[model samples]
Target chain A: MSNGQETSQETFAALEALKEHYSLPSLTFSVPRQVQGLVLPVVIAVVWEALAQTGILPANWLPAPSVVVATLLELLRGGELLGHIGVTLARVVSGFLIGALAATLLGGVTGSSPLVRRVLDPTLQALRSIPSMAWVPLFLLWLGIHESSKIALIAVGVFFPVYLNLLSGILTVDRKLLEVGQVFRLDRVQQVRRVILPAALPSYLVGLRSGLGLGWMFVVAAEIMGASRGLGFLMIDGQMTGRASVIIASIVLFALFGKLTDLVLERAAKGLLGQRGIEF
Target chain B: MGLAGAHRAALDIRGLCKDFAVHGGRVTALQDINLTVRQGDFISIIGSSGCGKSTLLRIIAGLETDYQGDAEFEGERINGPGLERGVVFQEHRLFPWLTVRENVAFGLGGGRENSRGESVREHIDLVGLTGFEQAYPHQLSGGMAQRAAIARALVNRPQVLLLDEPFGALDALTKIQMQEEVLRIWRAEGATMVLVTHDIDEAVFLGDRVVIMSNRPGTIKRIIPVDLPRPRDRGSYEFTHLRSAIYAEFFRQEDKPFAYAI
Candidate 1:
């Protein structure tokens, strides 16, 4: 029994060694994951600031990280940055909601019915091919160069990905599951609500995230073309006045806000699906 | 036939024909199929691959509509799928988003009142999945998921339960265990079951009559009654004899050209 115990102990130790060898490397210092993610960004900012301080890199054309931060702080102090951010946020939110709603309706119609798919899918595919910038002039002429045109441009950008993803998502719902719906004698509406929508949810969530990313992109384009206010306007104003720090600050804010919004969407998707591996 | 014929028919199919369109031409899947399933009878359909055994089950389930001839349930024409006939597919087909309880409850549909007042809990317990009510489908083993699917089919108290190769995916041990579980549920529920399988032993073990079929332009070749008492011993001579009888039918046609052989 003692000899058996010794052999078992040796086997256990070997198993432990094998596990350690195969396991992903854990951090030695036990730093939180969120803080760990910040390390690279902090390192880059410090290096850029040091280079500027040493006069190795010129600050006028490409502002130092600290100068951009200082400029952002100045804008915050004047309360102008908040207004610009609010305007941009409102535009993106409205455009995203509109685009998502329209896509859901049309995607449902075309995805479920082959007849509608044959009638509309080709035309939608053609419309999707035209570049985002091409829509800017048409949107301006149709909706005017105000918030409407900007939102419209973002809506058009947001529409395609969501629509396409939802369409394919609905189209590809497992025929087996639909057969279950049929066997259970679920009506047409019940089939849509109970089977198709839930099965297609993961893909739909993917579309929403991509649509949101595109919404951010188109909002930038919309603002840059001609905006009285917004981060895009701030960038243009800074460039015209030769304030490179302010321009860099606006760019930084856009990056920050875009990432934050996407994070919100991802969190919502996670909460809705609960631990399923979302492809996006 | 005398024993099964004594009971009133739960499902009656006559002159059933099914065709599928291939690249250039139509291929016959099922041809001149005729069968009668009596009340509370367990019918197992055995065939080789491409025998259209599943196609027959689908036609009875009302999932296939373009078939020729009549399939009636309890003297009513099966124009489409109805609540009275529940089907369990090879895969569990549980909605991934719903829990086991939710998936079973879905058989009740959104707002349709359960007139019998039978609870989903009863069906879950019937399939021996009582403790797993809150579990997701992916968390369960193949046999366990299949059990949940059986529970979902039974929850509505369907008069005719159709199983299409339900245990075809399971390992040997799990398959045997699931077969026993199905037998128990069938006895308890008293629903007429038509199970499609390629396993001859499975057909002998559970079926009241095994309906053997010929391949490609599939047709019913014979229906042999299993008069053996339960619970059946798979090792018994009578059991092996029944199983081998079904096996001999498949190989008997080996020398003939398969499509034209029918």
Candidate 2:
């Protein structure tokens, strides 16, 4: 009878341990997470509007949020705002895709092979040290002041972050995991496809995000140099014509679109990594 | 001989010596080790830390080949890792990106998509992890993750399975449970297993024979055969007798003063 009781206790303890292991604390929020994030921004916007209404600041230098909104509406009604946004979005997307593809191929090669890393890393590092504006003049001369030069400038900006992050990711893959690949008798291609690539994916996604950010920054610089249309052109045109509200509207659009694209990339990355339960 | 044919021994190791190159000087890790594991036998190798028992197992698994030795499996020269011998590490080492199902399927390699899916499911069921097929490694308890690791190792249907302290990380209760599970699996699969561990009770409980090891240029000190019947009781007199006998070997080593070579 005593032995039976002890066995039952032991089984109960084991079951309790297992239950504890499986139970991860769920996070519950009264207010939605996105709404909580917006509280501070909303407060700042209200304060700024109040200050503008009191007439302490001049209208030409720092336009009110309302004034910027009106200017944006006027541009929208004229049907030119959408065209500028579309053209700017196209340049950024095209440049980002090209840069990411080339970086992934090169990063994979250098990350996996020591010989390739030794041969190419130094030259790439030197190229990365050159400023983004420095490439503008060279690219303009080489590809001419058109869509190609602008796209090339954006690609160079996108290249370094993606390449560096991916290379570091591959290099830092756990040695024990590599040993698992070896013990399983995985050949070179099999090792890359199954072990190294999957291990480096989280870092690769991170690189893509930062690379897209740099692509946006470079597009602005590209359009400022020479372009007939785009948000950057709108900003330049506003500056020349001394329209503070228009300049502010263009800046606001840049912020909105940049954040929108990042959220989209983040959503896609979450879908890819949802099963693994990795945090963004 | 092929795996299907009869063999003299599952693993044959003789005059095995290994060295490590540390800061330009060579440090001997294992020296003149000799052991022959019979087919369907469970051999437990016990040693203190840095005893090089793990190095010996790695050599047999073909993960470490830079050594002077004759390590053969079923009369074939072991040059590199092959599918015939599977290894389970201390850490589960499940790819975090892969689900339980996909991680097990990885053992069958990336080809023959349709045929191997059945085998992957079979191994997952064998480990009693059928319902949690889509779960990631972090979602599992330590014991469950290790079970998945064992399933992945056995998915290839290897004749020999090498375990490097496979249950060393589990809690006491879970460790006992996993030991019983392993013994049951050994009987079911009839695969020759070599388990390297530091636990005396564990070595006595699971092994058909226990090989004692000594450190500082590691070598096999003794090989004690266990004649206990199946489901051996831990509290039995015979069990304690064998456990103390192995403990005596380590106690004897402690009597001598520490010797340093510098």
Q: What is each candidate's DockQ, to 2 decimals?
A: 0.37, 0.46
How would you encode candidate 1's per-residue C-alpha lDDT over A13-83 as one tens digit per residue?
Answer: 99999998998887776768779988888999899989998888888877788788889899999999999
Worst 10 residues of 2 chain B by lDDT: B253-262
lDDT by residue for model 2 (B120-212), tens:
888888888999888998788889999999999999889999999999888899999999989988887889999999999999999999999
RMSD of each: 6.0, 6.6
- Expressed as tens digits, the lDDT of each residue in A1-280 for candidate 2 is 2235568999999999999799778585456866899878888888888888888778888877898899999999999999999999999999999999899999999998899999999999998898878988888899998899998888888988999999999999999999889888888888888899888988999999999999999999898878989999999999999998889999999999999999999999999887676888
Q: What is the TM-score of chain A alone in each candidate?
A: 0.87, 0.87
**Candidate 1 Cα misplacement greater than 4 A, ranges:** A1-19, A22-39, A113-119, A275-280, B1-6, B112-117, B256-262
lDDT: worst 10-residue window of model 1 chain A: A271-280
Error of 1 at B190 (Å): 0.9
